[model samples]
Target: MDYDVIIAGGGPVGLMLAHELGLHGVSVAVLERLTEVDETIKAGAINVPTAEALDRRGLTPALKAAEERNRAEYLKFVRERFGESAGPPPPPVKFAGHFAGIWLLGDRVDENDPDLTARGSASLVSGVRQQDIEVLLEERVTALGGKILRGVEVTGIESHADGVTVRAGEHAYRCGWLVGCDGGRSLVRREAGFDFPGTPPEITGHQAIVEMEGHEQLSPGWNRTGTGVYVHGPIPGRILTVEYDGPPVDRDTPITAEELQASLRNVSGADVKVTGVRSATRFTDNARQATTYRLGRVLLAGDAAHVHSPFGGQGLNLGIGDAVNLGWKLAAVAQGRAGEALLDTYTAERHPIGAWVLDWTRAQVLLMRPEPRALAMRGIVSDLIDTVTGTTYFVKRISGVWQRYDLPGDHSLVGTIVPGLEFADGSRPADHLHDGRGVLFDLGAAPETGGRVRRVTAACPDRPDLGGLLVRPDGVVAWATDASGGESPERALDTWFPPDRR
Candidate 1:
């Protein structure tokens, strides 16, 4: 079998990447080990940036609809036990970064301020389930002309000079480029000889979908204490979970009911009745990062590149970000629109951010550890919550807006995230970002692109911020400025597109 891009792992990030590229008419194949979407909804929510990424690609409506339906049924279930108010009623978040913030994301989210970014709320985020997200993405990808091959576990990958050859159960799939979203312990990364380095989880956790009567209120969307994380995501009838710092069990040991109840006692200070033990297994908050993200034609993403404590729920989200970053560049290179040099930027730009995410998750996990200094820091944080200033740094942890690599200082404005803007004609500047292409904002009357590059213009409050901003597929502003009728944006274009005037 031949393809443009073959994504190993049918998880959310791999599926999302496939859908994104398939929308652009890029041939993508998702090889997943699982046969069904199921109810292992570990990643329960997505943030503003990820939502916008989905929105730009036209998948937000299904997500919003699903959330709306889930909200009505969920609010009623909690109200009876927790009274009219459990903590803080959930907030209405309709803008870009809603789910990314923790406040409205949790059971009783902090709705102190809707306009100003809230640090506490950012940490309290909870919503969405992996199965639900995958179902939505699968339907979308198929509708947009993509292919998904299930029950195909990739056993090996051999990157030749021309492309990559993948072996999946007697199926030899060859592709120009390969993406590894296969989670931690990725077979592709191992085959490619990429090193995964970091500390293994100091604390182990067990996740389950147990049933408990009269304890519905006790099961908040997620409960965090010095011990670990307990997610109580409402899939209406069922509750899914991804936990850490769980039962006192050794590595690869089965979770015991006594351990779970004991941890519950420590965290909630109550003898929580445990029943209907659906699934239980111990997991450590091990933090790891791949030495390099790319090796020739093989690349790693999601849990493949970095696996950290799931405290921030960044495991799946960060992998999707990696997909969003690489899908286009691989497409561009395959189609010969850009040089191979563009591929180098994938690791250069994303690896650092991946490492940073691991570091932050490690810090959060450390606080959950049984260490004295860690407990002190955790107490410091708990007491300091009222001081909004003390919560500012964590806003990035929840919001995910702070995870970015260095940008060329030329357009200090360029390094920042490009706010989606509308032009006089009611056109969204982001609408033209598809089709495996780059966008150049031409402020001047006519662009002087020598034929190889394309330019379009849009205006907004900060449109005057630069001559014109050049944006790459991953939404990084390549170049821009006060249009001093000068040559920087054009120079930047040439830097990537080069002087190919055909």
Candidate 2:
């Protein structure tokens, strides 16, 4: 095989996957049709779980810098909108995400607070543009000696029983596996004949950065108009407007400044004139997911596997999750260290998450419908969200503090994020995960274990009950043991990374 894995599309998902594969010494190539990584400000909020994923790989410093830039921009906007007259900026906003058009309080959702957790300190959500994430991933991929071939479009794919062949024009690269990380309308997905089925779009959406003269009059929050919903935000001149009267957009047509202005007016019922357009794009509420993430030797990730409205900024987060989850499992298989059965777990674990996100976006679309019933529903949701219980639930769900995988084992912490444990050495267990190796963290009694696992001894004052934990490369707790070793740490290691014949 020319490479162990050939990834189509060098977006954030593909680049991050390349880095993950590279961490495991897998020979991988990324084919990107674009001459350069897109710099468009796509999704910006990297939820907590994803931040933890990046943190595990020693990407926290850069991630934190990116997030700080976003926070600065947010503070600037708040200052321009409300000066000292507002009295200390009203303590910044808390629990400030929204359901439908109803805004939640902001303090509860602040990602910068490391000590902000239901039980203890949790990882902060990183607020960086998706394009910036791709750039960072690309740098890491190159640093790890992975090859990313830009301006190369995937033209053909042929899957054999043992390996797969991908053709970009006349050049054919053979690899043990082919993964489509391309966007929605992915050629790889179409060529692989994966089944994509979901609900059609109910409304067309517009996002753009433009010079809108006197645009400050547009209220800086979610607005439900008679026609649809429009969100003016913490970022000035950035607009998100939805129009209910819509046949799905012809994505082939470029979105112009004039077109975006019309959308702004229709949705906001305001004469928002766009003097110039920096960049504009169109999307829809059409939610779809591939029936199966893998088809034989060819697999799918990111937008290729699922497409939904850009509601609540879930698409990018979901795609990144797929990359991390699939990366380690695929690398193990490619290195002939694990059975093909290992790959099946990728779909099993991620499909439910994808399905849930699709439904979540659909729910937001339902609430945003331009009708009295929709308005009433939004009020109901807002009321529910105002309660302490509702506030905690949304904070967890929106911030991804509640994400848990159903890995094997009966322990409560099993399949859940093994809460970030700080040790006596002032280092985190995640610091050892940078190499993409499963971790056997011994909190008290050290385990006698071996094979594709990194063993560490630490004192976790936060989680004293966690005597030992077998953490997957993806950071999911595969197994845990109390001081008595309820679940043998050795058995858990053998189950995931067995010391067996290749």
Candidate 3:
């Protein structure tokens, strides 16, 4: 085999999976159609879990820099549009996320809430662009000795019992496994025959950066017009408009300035004339998911596995989450460190998460419609989201701070992002999790941890009752304990990382 795993698409998700596999010393290849990364910001929000995932790998510095730049840009945009205020420019819009254009306020989140406190929710949401995320992941992948063959368009895929063959251009390469990360209309998914079933779109949405003479006519902030919703500002000339028109026949057709202007007028009911267009794209609420994330030796991740509306800014985050969940599992199987059955858990754990995201977007699409019932429902949701409890719930959901898998464990902490436990040395559990290995965080000096699972001593300041935790490479709690009185932690370790397999 030319590589242990071959990843199609060199976008953020593909690069992230490559980085994870590379960290485990797995031979991997990434094939991307684009010669270089696109600088335009596609999805602009990085949720909490994604930030933590990057932080564990020492990539938080880059993410922070991008966050700062994004914040500064937003501030500048606001000041330019509204003029500098005397009272310190209104604290950067505390409520950064929304559902169906209805804003969810961060200020409404009760810091003292018991559940929120236990989750160890940090200042995790950011407005960094997808391009920045790709750059950071690409850098890490290359540094870790992974090959990313850009400008190589994947043409065909053939899977055999022993391995899979990927055909790109004039070359055909063999790998033990193949992964599709190549976006919604994925070639690998189609050719490999993965059944993607979901709802078709009822509306078309357009986001563009354009230069217009009459841009001032369209007000900033969310506007629920008689036709559809149009949100402007947070940046100059940045327009996001939704039309109730049916899904377009050709999503791949390049968006022209005139077409965008017409759609803008139709949705906004304003004759905003476009002078020049910078960049634009079209999207829909057409949600879909592969029946199974894997088919024999071929697998799927990111957009290749599922597709949903960008309503909650979940597309990029969901894709990265897939990479995080699949990377270590796939690497373990490829390296013979674990059985093929381990790969089955990836689908079992992630399919529900993907389904939830698809449904989440579907709900938002329903709320955005002009129907009287939807409008009434939108009003009710708007009120609920303005309160402390409701805002916290949405924030937790959108930020992915509440993500939990259904692992076999009795502890409430199991299958959640391990609480950010701090140590006496001022280092946290995340500090030791960088190597992409499962951790037996022995808070009570547990004796069973040694070879396969790395052991660490940390103070569980928040939950002193918990003696230890078995953390997966993705920073998820596989098993956790309230005390070392039992052998459950050790048993959990054996179940997940059997020494016999190694």
Candidate 4:
């Protein structure tokens, strides 16, 4: 085999998986179609789960730097808009997120909530671009000794009992495993014959960074109008318009300035003229998910496994979640650390999340419609979103704090990302995950470390009742117990990190 794993896409998802595999000393290579990273206007921010994943990998410094840059840009915009009279730029409204253009204010969130209090640095959303995330992951992948073959579009795949053979143009590479992180129109998903099933597109949305005239005529921030929805100017020259006029005829066609102008006018009724478009993309609320994440040796992740509307900025975060969840499991299987059945859990755990995202986006689509019923529903939702309870509920869902896998054991922490527990030594659980190994946080006489699991004996002042925690490499809590007697870690270890399973 040319590599332990060959990833078909060098987007953030593929690069993240490559980093994970390389961390486990698995030989991996990423095959990307683009020669250079495109500056397309994509996801503008990442959610809590993605931020925590990166934090575990010791990428918080870079994330903070990116956040500062984004903050500076937002501050500049605020000053320009408010004429500098507004003191300190109002600290750039830390919003939880939005639903159907309805903003979820961060100030309204219940900070005492367990999910919110548990997340240390990842408690807030990070204002970083998807392009920035890809670049960061690409750098991390390379630094971890992973290869990235640019301009190598995977054309075909042949999955055998032993391994899979990937074909790209004139070359073929063999690997123990192949993951399709390729976008919505994934060639690997098609060649692997995974059944993709879901609803069709109903609305067409345009997001762009353009030089335009009459831009001021549009409302600032999210606006749900009688026609559709349009967002203007948090970032200079940035605009987004949504119209329930069906999907684009040809999504492959380039988005011209004229087309953008028409969309802006149709949605905002601003008569805006897009004089020059810097970057643009067309999207729709066409939601779909593969029946399974893996088909034999060929697996899928990111948009290859699922595709949904970019509303609420869920697509990028969902892809990152898929990559993180699948990365360690695939690496363990590829390196012969675990049985192949472990791969099945990837689909079992992620499929439900993907389905929920599709439903979430579909709900937003329903609310965003300009019809009377949708408008009435939107008003009720808006009212609910204004309250503290409503804000916290939506924030928890949007931030991914509400996500918990259905694993064995009745413990509350089981199947949830272990809270960012800071020990007596000032080191957190995330600090131990940098090496991509499972951790046994031995708070009160936990079991000894297995070959693949690292044991960290530390005193947590806050949660003294927490006896110990068995954390998977991906940060999910497999088993946890308080000071009193509960389920032992042996079963969880045997299931997730069995010693020398071949």
Per-prediction CA RMSD (Å): 4.9, 2.6, 1.9, 1.5
Q: Looking at candidate 1, what is the lDDT of residue 390? A: 35
lDDT of each: 0.65, 0.82, 0.84, 0.88
Write candidate 4's Cα lDDT for 236-347 as tens digits.
Answer: 7888989988899999998999999998898888877889999999999889999999988999999999999998889999999998898888888998988999999999
- Residue-level lDDT tens digits of model 2 in 1-502: 9999999999989998999999999999999999997755589777777888888888888887887887777776666666634432454243346667666776445454432343222265456789778878999999998999999999999999999999999999999999999899899999999999999887888887778876767888788888887877566567888888864548778778888888888877787789988877789988999989998999999999999999888999899999999999999889888888889989998999999999988999999897888878888888888776676677667667677777768888888766777777887777878899998888886567854577788888766766888889988888887865676666567667866447
Each model's total of backbone clashes: 17, 12, 0, 0
Ranking by lDDT: 4, 3, 2, 1
Residue-level lDDT tens digits of model 1 in 439-478: 7777553355665555786554545544676776666666
- Indicate the worst ten consecutive residues by lDDT in candidate 4: 86-95
Question: What's the distance in Å from true for residue 4, model 4?
Answer: 1.3
Assess every candidate by TM-score.
0.83, 0.94, 0.96, 0.97
Question: Which 10-residue window of candidate 1 scores lowest in summed lDDT?
Answer: 93-102
What is residue 241's positional error in candidate 2, in angstroms?
Answer: 0.6
C-alpha positional error of residue 422 in candidate 3 after TM-score superposition, expressed in Å:
1.4
How would you encode candidate 3's per-residue C-alpha lDDT over 139-162 as one tens digit per residue? 889999999999999999999999
Arrange candidates by TM-score, highest first: which order?
4, 3, 2, 1
Clashes, model 3: 0
- For candidate 4, the clash count comes to 0
